[model samples]
Target: MPRPDRPTRPSARSGVAPFHVMEVLAAAKARQRARGDALLLCTGQPATPAPRRVRAAAAAAAAEEVLGYTEAAGDPALRAAIAAWHRGRYGTAVTAGQVVVTTGVSGALILVFLAALDPGDEVVLARPGYPAYRNTLAALGAEVVELDCGPDTRHQLTAEMLAALPRPPRAVIVTSPDNPTGTIIDEAELARIARWCAAHGTLLVSDEIYHGIDYGRRCASALESSAAAVVAGGFSKYFSMTGWRLGWLILPEELVGPVTRLAANLTVCPPAVSQAAAAQALHPESLAELDGHVRRYRDNRDLLLEGLAAAGIDRVAPADGAFYLWADVSDYTDDSLVWCAELLDRTGVALAPGVDFDAVHGGGRVRLCYAGAPGDLAEACRRLSRVTGRA
Candidate 1:
C-alpha cells in the first residue's frame, strides 16, 4: 500500500561511488599488455611478495593442514601474535583476548562499525584521507563528517580539530602514514587525540596498516593512550600479504564479543590457511626479511621525489611515510580524472586522481604511489617532465 522508494530497483547503498583508481588500473594493465611500457603509480600495493618465511609457511600449511574455517575470531596463535606485536612495538598492555582477526583491515572496519555504531551516528574523518573509510561509513548509514585538514597540521586531524567540532562525534578514525598524503601523525598529537576521545566518550578507530613502512616517524598506537580506543590493523601493508587478506583488530574488551559475533555471522571465519600462514609473518626471521622491503620503498620514494621535482611536479605533501605523494595539479588541469586519463594515454603512466580521495579541493590534485619499481617510477617522471616542457 506504500509508495516504494526504490520502485523495485536495487538498494540505495549500492550507489556508493567506486574508487576511480580501479579504472586507471584497468587501463594501465591494458596499456602494459599492448605496449609493455606502462608505469603504474595509481595503486597502493607493494610490487613484492609476502616474506620468504611466510610464503614457505603458507605452502607448508596448504599442503599439510586441513584448510577449513578457523574460529570466528581467528586462529589463537595469530591473535596472540598480533597482540604481542602491539605490546612490543607500543609498550601497550594488549592481550590476545582483545584481538579479533578478520578477513582484512577492510573487514575489521566493517565489523567494528556495525558493532559500535547505529545509523545516523556521526563519524568524523579527515578530507584527503583514505576514500574507503568515507565510502564504507556512508554505506553503513553513518553520518560522515569530513574535516578539512591542511599543510599546517600535516594534513592530519588533531585534538584541536575535534574540540572545534560542534559536538563530539560518535566515532572518529585516524590514519597515520595516511594514503595519498604519506604524512604521519606525531606521537604527541596522537596521544592528545586519544585522551580527547576517551574524555568525550567517543570511539577512536586507528587505522595503522602502514605502521612498519614509515620513513622514521614513530607510529604510535591508540592503545598506548586510551584503553577505550580500537585499532584496525592488517598484514596487507607492512607484511606484504595483501592477497592473503588477513587482518586483526585490537578492540576494547567490551567490543570483542560484539565484533566476533558479527564476524561469525558476516564472514563465518577468516581464511584458515591465511591465518596459519600469517602467524609466520610475525616471526623475527620474517620481520628481518620484510625490513629489506622497507628499504626498497624508501629508495623508491626518494627517487620519485627527485624526479618529480625535476619535472616541476613539486607541489606535494611531505610524504613522511607510506608510499604516496599527494600533489596539487591545479596548474595543469581542473579535471583530475581527465588529467589522469590523458597522462596515461600519452605517457603510459597512471596516477590516482585526487578526487577519489577528497571530493573537495581534489579536482587539480593527484596521488602518485611510489610502491612500484624504481626504474618505472623514474620513467614515469621522465615522461611528465618532457610533456611539461613542451606545453
Candidate 2:
C-alpha cells in the first residue's frame, strides 16, 4: 500500500502491446453500422455457429437442470470426453485427471504461465505469431524471446533454432495452423522439436486451437511426441464456439494439481453451461456438421488466394491450414496500420495490419481472414484491386 501522501501507480507488468486487429475490428463495426458497406476481413475465428448438438445440449442443460458452477477443473464427463478426444485424435495416452478446463485458451495460458513461469524467466515465441500470447506472457512478467521466423520456415520455430540458442529458455510455444500467418508445422519436424525440448528440459507449450481446419497437410499435437508438453486448445476457432467461452488444457501428471489449484482460485470455474454442453461437441452428429464448415473454409482460402494474386499481391505465406492469408503489401505501402486505415475509410475493407504481430517486418504486411461469407471475400478483393491498380 502506498502512503496517503503519494499516489498509487500502475505496475510495469501492465505495459504490454494491444491487439491491433481488435482495434481495426471496432472501427470496422462502426463503419458497418454507419454505411452498411464494410467488408470485414480483419476478424479471426470462424464465422459460423456452434454445432447443432452442442447448441441443443446447451438449451437442454439450461431448461432441464440448475446451471451452477462446476468443479474448478471442469465437469467430470466433459474432461473425460476431451481426454478421450485427444487420445483418439493423436494416439496420446491422455487421461481425464490431466484435463483442466478453462474459460478459453486465453485462460488456460494464463493458468499455465502462472504455474510454470516466474518473472524474468525467458519464453520463446515465433515472430509474427499470435499477439495475445506475447502480450499475456509479457504482462505476467516473463521475458519473451521472439525467433525471427520468415517464409523459410513457414513462420514457425524449428528444433535447430532452439539448439542454437545460448541456452534453452524456460519455455517455447508452438502454434500449428498459427494465427496471422496460418501455417501448419510439419509433423516430423514437430516431433523432433518435442523430443528436443524434453531432452533439454525446456517446457513446450503447444497451442493447437486451430486444429481440424487444415487443408492438404495434417496438424500434429505435441502430446503425440512428448507427454511433458503443456497443450492448450479451445472450442473457439475450429468448433465455432467463440462465445461459448470454453477451452481446456492437457497437463503432465505433475502439473495437474498446481494448474487446477490456480484455476480454482483465479476463475473459480469455466462457464457451467459450456462445460455441460461442450461434451456434445465431440459427438458424431456434431462433428459431421463441423466438418462441413471446414470444407467452406478451404473454398474461401482458395478464392482469397486467387483474388490476391489478381490484385498483384504475389508474396504470401503458405496457408496450409486455418482461414488466414498472410500477404506482403510492401508494394502498396510501407506502413500496414496506415494502409489498413485508408482502405477501410476509402472502400470499407477491413484488414489486419502486420505491425500488430511482427514489430520488425509487419509494416509492409497484412493478414486477411477468409472465414466470413464467400461473397464478401470476393467483393473485398474487387475493391482492393482498385487500390492496388493491378486489375
Candidate 3:
C-alpha cells in the first residue's frame, strides 16, 4: 500500500494539511463502535435534526419534481429566498443576481479562492482560524499570511495588523464567531478592517457560517462594511443541516459571473433535494426551530464553561458565540495531540487538538464542541473531571 506522504502520483495539492477535527471525529466514531462509550466533543455539528418544514420540502421536491440539475447559479427561487433572507437578517440590500449556490461553504471557499487568487498570490487571515482557510488556499498555491491574533484582540484580525503587512495580499478572510475561539469581532473594529482592505485593494472574504448562533450580541456581516465584500454562508451550522451540503456566496457584480462560471464547472449544481430543503430552511417556521437549538447550545456552553472552571481549566477563550469552547489545557500537557489521544483512551472524551487551528501555540490548546445534548455535555464534564483528577 502507498503511504500518504509517499504516494506515487501525489500532486502538490495533495500535501495540504488535513482537518484534524475530522480525523479525531473518525477516531471517536471507531472507538464508539468498538467500546460504545465515546463522548464526542470534536467537530461543530449540531445534535438537532432538520426542521419538519425543511424535511417536508425536500420530500415534496423528491416526489413532485425532477431531481435534475438546476441552473449553475442555483434555482432562481432559492437564490431569491437567500437574498430575501439576507436582506431581512442584516438589513443589507442583497439581490438574487448576487447569490450563487454552492455545494457547501467548503465549495464556496474553493470557488472564491479560484476566482480571486492566482498561483503564488497571498491571502491574509487571523491565526487560529478555521484550518480549511489555510489548507484550501495552500492547496490552490496561495501563500497564507497569518496575523497573530491573541486574546488581546479577541482572537480577531485588526486594521493595524493589516496595515503593517509588508504588502497587501490578494484577499483577506475574516470569520465572526470564529472557529477555535468562538470570539466575535467588534462591529466597529470589523468595519475598520474592511475599510483598510478596501483602501489597500484587497478582496474581503467573510466567512459567516456561524451567524444566527450568537449568544448575546448578534454578529455583523461584512456587507455592512463594504459593498465589494464576498460573503460565504451555509445551512450547515445555524440551520443544523450539515448533511444537506447547501451553501452560498454573495458576490459583487463583477465577480458574480466569474464565480458562477467556476461553480458551473466545479459541481455543475448543488443537490436538487438540498436546494429545495434549504429554501424552506429560511422559512419562519424553520428559523423558529433553529432558534430553539441555539438556546440549547447556549445552555450547554454555560454548563461547559462552569465545568471547565471547576476542573481548574480556567484559561479558556471568551466564547461570545458559537457552540465551541477553545480551552487552554497547557497545565495538563504540552502536546495537545498526545493529550487528546490519551484523553480518548482513558476517558473516551474526544476533542480537537489546538494544533489543528494554530501550528505554533496549538500544542497547548484544544477545542471542545458544546453542540451535543445537555446530558452528554454533563457526562463529558464528569469524565473530564475524573480524567484530570479534579477534586
Candidate 4:
C-alpha cells in the first residue's frame, strides 16, 4: 500500500516553461472581454481558413475509409511524397526512407531531442528564438545554452558564435524564417553553420516550419549539406493547416530506427485522417492553394512593415520571412511583459512579449504577428500608434 503522505515522484527533466506569448494573449482576451472591446491582435495563427483542397481531402478521406493508426514513422506514401517534394522544390536528392511523418513540428522536436541527446547533454540555441527549443531541451534533461544573436547578425546563430562556446554542445538548433524575428538565413551563412556543426560532431536540428512563406530567396534545409542534420517542417504555416496537426521530418538514416521506436511508444502514430488529408496537401492543386496564402502573408508583411515605420516603432529587423515582426520597445519601456499587458488593457491591442522568446534581452522588445486579417492589422497598428503616442 502507498503512503498517503508520500510526495509524488517527478521526472528529472523540469517541466516545460510557459510560453509568455500565450500568457499575454490570454490576458489580452480577458481584458477585451472586461472592457467590451471589439478587436484583438494577439494571435500567431492565420486568419484565413485552411485551403479548400486540404479540407476536401480530409473530408473525402473521412468518407472513404475508417481512419486507423499509421506506422509510427508515418504512411509510406506520405513519406514518399514528402521526399518528392524536397527534390522538386530544392533539387535536393532524398529518398522516402529518410522522411518521418510526425504529428506536428513539435513532435518532431521531441523526437529529435530524445534521439540526439543523453542526460546532461547540452544543446545550443539562439536567444530571442522559438521558446519551444529551450523548453523542450530542458524537459528532456538537456541544458539549453543560449547564444545571443541580435539584430546585427540578422537574429541568427552563426559559426563564429558556435566556435566561441566554452564546450561544444552535443547539438545545435537553428530556425530559418525564425519565429518572433521572421529572419531567414542565407545560403552562405547556412553552409558555414552546417560545416561547423559537421566538423564539431554537433547534431544540427533545422526548424523549417516557415519555409514556404519567404519574401525573397526560398529557405534552405540543412539536409542540403549534412546527412547528420534533422529537418523538421510542417503544414501549419504555409499550408494553413494548423488544426490538421500534421508535420514530417527528414532524419539521417542512422537515427531513423531510434526515432521510430520513440514515436511508436509515445504517440503510437499520427492520426490516420490527418495523414490522409496531408497526402492531399502534397497534391499540385493543393500546393497552388497554399501558394495563394503565401501571397497574402507577403502582403500582410508589407502592411505591417509600413505600419510600424509610420507608427515610429521603426527599429525592427528586416522581416525576410514568416508572419512576425520583432520590434525593439526599449524606447517606451524595458519590461515588455508589463508594456504588453498595459497595451492590451488600454488599447485592446495584444502582442507577445520578447521575454517569452529570450528571457535575457526579450524584456526590451516585443513580437507582433501579422497573420491576422488586413483590417485587423490596420486596426492594431492604429491602436498601437495611439497607445504608444506615436500616432
Best by lDDT: 2
- lDDT (0 to 1) per candidate: 0.91, 0.93, 0.90, 0.85
lDDT of 1 at 207: 95
Error of 3 at 19 (Å): 2.1
Q: What order do you get sorting by lDDT, best first?
A: 2, 1, 3, 4
Error of 4 at 378 (Å): 1.1
Off by over 4 Å in 1: 1-8
Clashing pairs in 3: none
Better of 1 and 2 by TM-score: 2
Q: Mind giving the per-residue lDDT tens digits that candidate 3 earns over 181-247?
A: 9999999998998888889899999999999999997699999989989999998999999999989
Q: Model 2, residue 72: what's the lDDT? A: 96
Name the runs in model 4 displaced over 4 angstroms.
1-12, 31-38
RMSD of 2: 1.5
Better of 1 and 4 by lDDT: 1
lDDT of 2 by residue, 270-357 (tens): 9998888999999988888988999999999999999989988979999899899999999999899999999999999999999998
TM-score of each: 0.97, 0.98, 0.97, 0.95
